[model samples]
Target chain A: MNWDYLLSLFMGGLTRGSIYALIALGYTMVYGIITLINFAHGEIYMIGAFTALIAIGVLTLAGWNGTAILLIAAVAAVVYAAAYGWTLERIAYRPLRHAPRLSALISAIGMSLFLQNYVRMAQTANFLPFPNLIPEFAFLKPVAHIVRSSELVIYAVTALVMLLLTLLVRFTRMGKAMRATAQDRDMAMLSGVDVDRVISLTFVIGSAIAATGGVLIASHIGQINFYIGFLAGIKAFVAAVLGGIGSLPGAVLGGLVLGWTESFFTGYVSSDYEDVFAFLFLVGILIFRPSGLLGRKQMEKV
Target chain B: MKAEFKKSLLAALWFMFLTFPITVVRVNTIERTVAWRWERLIWIGAATFILSFIWRRLLHRKQTGRREVSAGEVRPPSRWKQMAADPRLKGLALSAAALCFLVIPLLFSWNKTILVTNALIYVVIALGLNIVVGLAGQLVLGYVAFFAVGAYSYALLNYHFAVGFWAALPMGAALAAAFGLLLGFPVLRLRGDYLAIVTLGFGEIIRIVLENWNALSFGPSGIDNIPPPGFFGLALTLRQTHIAIYYLMVALTLLTILVVHRLQHSRIGRSWEALREDETAAQAMGIDTTGAKLSAFALGACWAGMAGVVFAAKQKFINPGNFTIWESILVLCIVVLGGMGSIAGVVLAALVLVILPEALRVFADYRWLLFGALLVLMMVFRPGGLVNARRRAYAFEPSAPEKSERP
Candidate 1:
């Protein structure tokens, strides 16, 4: 492959992978803390996209400019998604904490189905065009033909959010509580940390980040459907696992790897076999290193 | 107050029933016929309920003089005490087995050959899933991926290579098993929900490949005119004769059941149970946990492959949509509802799941609602399944010379 073309492809993969990484963090965080896969996270992403779409529509109706509309929509999407995520955990998952894992999984599946079909029923099954809120500036026009201004915006937004998340996790008191609860819920409870609150807060933060990713993806793609999250969610989950399920930075690394592999497979081989390649890679990694690249191998207590 | 509550409830039901027709008449022709029939059925159902209540009361009054016995408790028989004392319960079970062998085929109408064939197909799938979910305790969400592989393998091989059905059958199973091994290598380490998520991803990936791969899968139009099985020189197709296919399916189903039953009682089965109960302990016990897990995956996929070939032959049309996530979930539901490790339970569960929907065609829209409710209720009340697998007692006999040892 030509070096320039390969470089561009790599960059493209990184951009896409960053979005997946953001979503994967949500999965990894929840799994790390409670050992539960927040199956409804995908729907939270969907809700985020819709929230942005609605926000854009309302802003446009009131004759807001592109910049103002984008800012307003992003904030609204994050807030709405965070609230929805919190509510879903409270209603569907909270009561089932003491129940069997199978029951919780079933309930999660049910909630996912309900959310997906509900959206399908409310909105037309067809893809709706996202608002062109981000302006196209020629800042990167000299460097490459492939990189669009919209893509640059996506990269910037993702980087900013990730930085903020890192800072929050590293320094904040709430973050400490969240980390403590994740390490050992019983111990955290004994130490005066409200485990339930920490868990809820974890969901809210993760969902907010996922929502941000959703908005960026929608803005980049220009159009989105109700079922868009199904594949992306799976890929993100893969990314989370590949990066070591509970590790934050691992999610990012796994996302990037997955994205690059997918992009390269589609670019060189066939788009049809893109998933085949990705899963094959996953299987290979899992067999060789079950703890993932950065994850510590957990020992089971009998 | 109870009597008044009952009367008011009855009045409310009656009023609603009467209003249902006027509402239907106001709508279109299709709506009217459906509504009218449903309302009339409700009225007839109420009358039957009243009659049954009266009959039950009379029966209870007539039987008042009889001694009452506790529910599900039976008195020991004096005549058969010697046989019953064996403790194995095998002697007691032979009669039930004989009754089942005689009644099942005769009780149901044989005219619905298609239903029997479908049930057989489900039985095969249930057995296949039983290995992964029941034996291995690995929750697989993309089981239909193997089925699709098997179907497509047959279709592609038969059409391009001009291979016969018999040749394609084993080839298809092998191909699916290979994929299962491939998927299992990475995911075998993950447990519970994590494993489930990965498998779900795998299933979606397979479907997406099938959908987008225009060169191979023909992209949505799907492969048609898949040839039927020909034994020796006789060509057996759905159009010519369904009985042959029905018999073939039944034979295959029985073979599957027998194999699974044997496997469950075998050393390998014990290993699987060990893994399910405690993977660490099983590993400590010198069981090759990884190998056992992979075997379960391979075996499960192999069964799914066999079922897929049957499905493709029966339909004579194979497509990506045919093997979907929903189908996988349905198979999983059958296994769970049937009581995971029990063969007879899954068969019965499959029968109910398949037959119930067909029976409730009139209320098609509400069928899923009913199913959802039933699932919740079943999990709540009868989570162990209809026929639970109880522990078999030892058949050892006690000697009558304990006084010598004491002395």
Candidate 2:
């Protein structure tokens, strides 16, 4: 029955799903708060990877240790990405808040294009080889064939992050404000919540999460390019939609579902049409279940 | 003013800090080398400092402008618009524009003629997109897929059989319209952002399939040596053929303008506009939102298909790369920047967008970067577009004061 092969594919899917979950978290959170797709969110992820690579290059040249370099690089990426996210919202979205939905969407698309070219021009157009920072663990030698050490690390990190996020969103006062703002911006504003601050904070947190995903995935893939964000962003958006956009847990579930779907399809069928399968699956879900798996359906107000 | 200066300085510093990692530091990981271009940081600081002032002023104006608009102040129309609206000036402008279009190819060089022809093609495509996005309010990001359908229909038909361009043109439009209807049927129920993503996915799906499906699309290498449109068995040289194609595009563009302008004034067009404004209201008014939306998609696709066939004939080659998401976005930009639902604006924007890059060959590298920034800026400052679409204003005659109400 080839249980081992299936198990490996499962683990691979799990790893991939966690990465998508990381990026999807950003998209879902932003969409939840603003109801805007935040098309530039993917570009934030790419920026995170680029920032991390720059940090790594500098730190390594200064004779820093591996662990310290990784830690500093990750922090740098997150902070820079958060800043980018904040500025992006202020510049591209803030003014369009009262405009038509189409205007904001077009603005977002424009921001995405601008950022892609910005990175491409700032960095080289060619693909950069990302250094593998995750070290091999000796404890998992026997079951190494089933899952690599990086996969285990990914699972643990994703779980820890998810737990922390859940705690923050559920237990904190700021989280309460964020939730209120997401529920209804005008109401929140009337209730004395700083809606603008909440929205900015939402962008910061989402971009930070996306940056973490960007760094981890770039390290895993061992390469970085300016165009990576577009496809990954779309796929993650799909994941966010699949689970029920605007729901955190839904994003994770959607990511896992999308991951498994792609992994299994690639494993059994020809890998050539793997992307087609994901898109077709999305089309199917959107047609049959427009609100997604966990999304609440709201009646249109006249 | 001093406070504004302080704010600008702070913004400049914040931007410098934000851009430090990417702009100031260049890292070559494989070689373990890092280059610090500190000058770039200075440039960023200077640029942001100056831009912040302009941005703040514009934002102030926009906020005040909104209030004035909501207060029902009748702002005077711009001179160009007023001239366009006046019958006497409008006729003069139209004749002048028509004369320029007719005489341009005859006087211009071959390359310039070709460039103008390309711009005309975009004018048609952008007008088509204007119908779907501007009129119907469906954000179709994969509009180029239909264009590809038309292009490939002509390419494959000519390659496989002895089908000529004249026969393939209508076939291409029909095929694309069918494809549009196919995509529109199920997706008509979805809302804005979801619809956008689905269309985008549809676009990528088409591109990927074309790239992988070697049996049909000839893979990524694409089909080459496509013969240009036949001229009734008249053998013309290469230059003459290009000139003829230019005239063909001119005629096609005028025809598209006529069709689009008529459609915009038609009953179905009003329905589309109503649906765009409010779906529930439109449906309650018995506008048949489904038919209006589907027709918008199909009609838009129909024009794109025609343009696609023309584009293929012009290039004398067909490739999947020609129909990327970027091309669709370019047309979208033309529609948006020109002012959605404005025919003259779309034509003007298409000409500017297509010809500007060709005119400024030195700034080719920064073309997309500038386009991206322009989009954001346009949305922020002028969402109404370069030339705002004028609503059909009917003269309202006020009734004389009644003697009974005078007391």
List, residue by residue over B313-337, the lDDT tens digit for candidate 2: 8898888888899998888889889
After superposition, candidate 2 runs with Cα above 4 Å error: B399-407
* TM-score against truth, every candidate: 0.76, 0.98
Error of 1 at B374 (Å): 8.1
* TM-score, second chain, candidate 2: 0.96
Against the native chain B, what TM-score does each candidate's chain B reach? Answer: 0.73, 0.96
Question: Native-contact recovery for every candidate?
Answer: 0.17, 0.84
| Best candidate, DockQ | 2
**Model 1 regions lying over 4 Å from their true place:** A1-11, A54-72, A95-107, A138-145, B1-116, B160-163, B166-171, B185-188, B201-221, B231-240, B355-407
- Fnat, model 1, is 0.17
Candidate 2's residue-wise lDDT over A215-275, tens digit each? Answer: 9888888899999999889889989999999999999999999998888889888799988
